[model samples]
Target: MKNPNGFGSVYKLSGNRKKKWVARKTISWENGKQNRKIVGYFETKNEALKALANFEYIENSKITFKQVYDLWSKKHFENIGHNRATNIKSRYKVHLSVIDNVSICDLKIKDLQKLYDNLNLSSGTANQIKSILKMIFDFAIRNEYIDKNPIDYLEVKKHKSVLERKIFTSEEIAFLWNNINLKLVDTVLIMIYTGLRIEEFLNLKIENINLEERYCIAGSKTEAGINRLVPFNHKIIPLITKRFKEKNTYFITCNNRKISYSTYRRAFIKLMEDLNLKHTIHDCRHTFATLMSNAEANPASIAKIIGHKDYKITEKIYTHKDKNELIKAVDMIN
Candidate 1:
């Protein structure tokens, strides 16, 4: 069988005869410039030769950005964390997967910008997509697939508007306590006083409670959150004593059954609706922080108590001034 010396050769191995065609072309130029390399195998001899021809043709015509990016992503994200890799792949599936067939040369800055802007995702998510796109384009440039990265000029817009969270006032809190089932009131009050996230509160086990030390160790969302010792408020003690007698395995439960997220969510929603309040169960945490701030509690201490990674988050977002506190402060103007 005769094959061109410069072009790739297609051959079947002796032991694996009738196997699919295997083709290999050297990574060298036509003008006597050579490099040591073996390229690939294909389903047929024509397919192998066609790949070689395209390899030569690609010098003049560009490959798709998708083709370049897919290769790039494999190497780029190989060393990243599993959770992070999953997140990046999820974004690619939703946003970048469609444009995989578009040529790199045809992709302009505006084309990418339009794709990003159309998503209308959260600030954090939008920024993640922008960062990933730039990396993909940078990969294309480094691989000689494109001259410059169009993603360099792209800007991800921030959603400037912040959502207003509803927190309960002292009066509203008392009204809620007075209205709900006496048994459920303990769980609600624990969340309000302890500043524990609803899920964290639900996951508390019998061993996690330390009555001798007066601080129950719980919370597992972040490094700061894990095993945080939240001191029990005096009011929730009676409820604890009652539960201790019942000998339930978990801290929060219904008839010895674990209080699932859905069950708690439904109960919270029902309570809010009954009270005609516009607040989620998480607002109990906000209320605790607000009350602490009003009592002149240290911001750093508040952050630590609530399992915040940084105290600045507590100062900036959690420690808000109530209307009564604002009025009292203004009255002190002499």
Candidate 2:
């Protein structure tokens, strides 16, 4: 029968499992063409009535995608992280004009997939878009804006892994230590010695350093960003001392501001070219792990130093045993 609101009709279907309720709405275009659509199925008759009410409201109000996204953003800003929210808002702006006039309920998976695939974005980036859509739909479903998640079955194509752990040779490490510009020499040395992520290094403060203890406190990027004390060797001590003499600030910087990752990466690329080495800034951390493993540093000790949440993750990524050492251990059993 016709809904009192005049937006749609509701019907019940018999099934072995349970009774299913369905709502249908019709839309007329400027060309005098009409299209009928089934909004959703509900498990309970009461839920179906609620769905019919919502459908009537949506159809009557002619709500837009932008309007719903804005409403969703307001309700769930805290659910998203700071870094992620920034990117999501930026991407939404780019796609807003094309989809803004479209109804929220009419947002099909194909439309989203087409938008996702047409962009010349990395797989990681595509996944982020997918995640934002998922969050939006999840909020809608939770609030009963929609009965089911339309984009739930959308598959994000996986990109081939390009990042490999490159173990820097001793010569390459020595070359980098000796050849990088003197301005960033101390900062690079600190990374080599401490294996701190770029963000952690940039955020380092003078108060975190304990000169007497020959260590510094820093946080990691991962959820394991708990404060950890990293010990410094003799080589790093001189570098830190020299920096302490030159700058009042805790970190090495150009023009009194913290160095950006892009700046460091460009400089590192030049350094790599000069040394004829092919390695990423990440190689410094891998080199640290390699050297530590070669020195027979205990996995537990290394994990604690690296602020890894568990030794198993450390073992999975960083524990590469030497062939000769393995042979020696095997011989001992014989």
Candidate 3:
């Protein structure tokens, strides 16, 4: 007897097979051809019939991986911090391209494992990808799109990192100091002397600087760093005063307006090109830390001034120290 239309079919295959009964369904059609998909196999006709009846097809609603990710990230990105959301989006855009268009319901552990194994990234980055996949799968499951997450079984391989943070050498520092009158060179000196992260420096407001006290209350990225008092080195005091007198809302400005990192980055690239220096903006912070350590600044003072929450400093020294001690530490750099 013929089965009802669109109900799929169960039939027995030719003799040598152990699971002779096959369950098949018409998943799609193209150019007058029915694209039959194999649902599963069974040892008996009744078993195949039961399996076919129980099998779920994505005929009505097809949810692709990208679709789920879009839905998940739409609400998810709003609640998380900007940096974290940017990192997640970057990983998704760069690394998860393979499964982007594939239907979420069709994904399996082998596919996920293959995707993970093919990536050659740092352990932290690779693990982040795994975590992103897991969250997407969990979203699908929550929405009744899939019964289980394939990422649960997928394993990521870790690779050793060779990347190192390079700092400005003493000679390079001298070159910068001598050329400080050049365009945007003073900003580099400010970053180096104060140990401000690139973001913190870009976001520094004029109101935060106390010219007489010679310190700026500014920070970001970590609890220890936020709204902290960072004393200015005497060498950059002239530079700071000049910038402060500009009367712009932010101390760091270009053409009488607040400057952005991208704009500053382009200018920095040109400056580096001219000076023959190979360094990133963050390296200024590294140079500051190195200089302070060489001057034998207290470890706790270093951590406190830099917004790092070192265990030893946090437990023993950072709590007891005050702004005066930090000022003493800052003065040790030069």
* Residue pairs in clash, model 2: none
Query: Could you tell which candidate, 1 or 2, scores higher by TM-score?
Result: 2
Give the top-scoring candidate (lDDT). 3
What lDDT tens digits, residue by residue, belong to model 3 across residues 1-334?
8888988998888989999999998877899999887877889998888877876565424778988898779868989987688779878998996778898888878878887887777778888888998998898777567898888787656766645679898889999999989998999998999999988998898888898988999878898888988988888999988878536888887677877666787799899999999988888999999999999998888887788888354546685778788888889976
TM-score of model 3 vs. true structure: 0.64
| Tens-digit per-residue lDDT, 100-210, candidate 1 | 778888888888888987876777777888888888888767756678878778776775434466778888878766764644666777788778888788989888887
Report the Cα lDDT for residue 277, model 1.
78
User: What is the Cα-based lDDT of residue 147 in candidate 2?
Assistant: 71
Candidate 1, 167: how far from true, in Å? Answer: 1.9
- lDDT per residue as tens, model 2, 1-334: 5456456677788765464887766645556765666667777767777766665335523667676787679757778776566667777776544788887778888887777667566677667777777877786676456677877878677655556778777775676567545556566656766767777877787778777757778888765546766666656777887665234465656667766665677787876676577877887776666666676666655665666767665545533544333223222210
TM-score of 2: 0.53
Give the Cα error of residue 305 in candidate 1, in Å: 1.5
TM-score of each: 0.49, 0.53, 0.64
Candidate 1 clashing pairs, residues 3+ apart or interchain: none
Q: Model 1 TM-score? A: 0.49
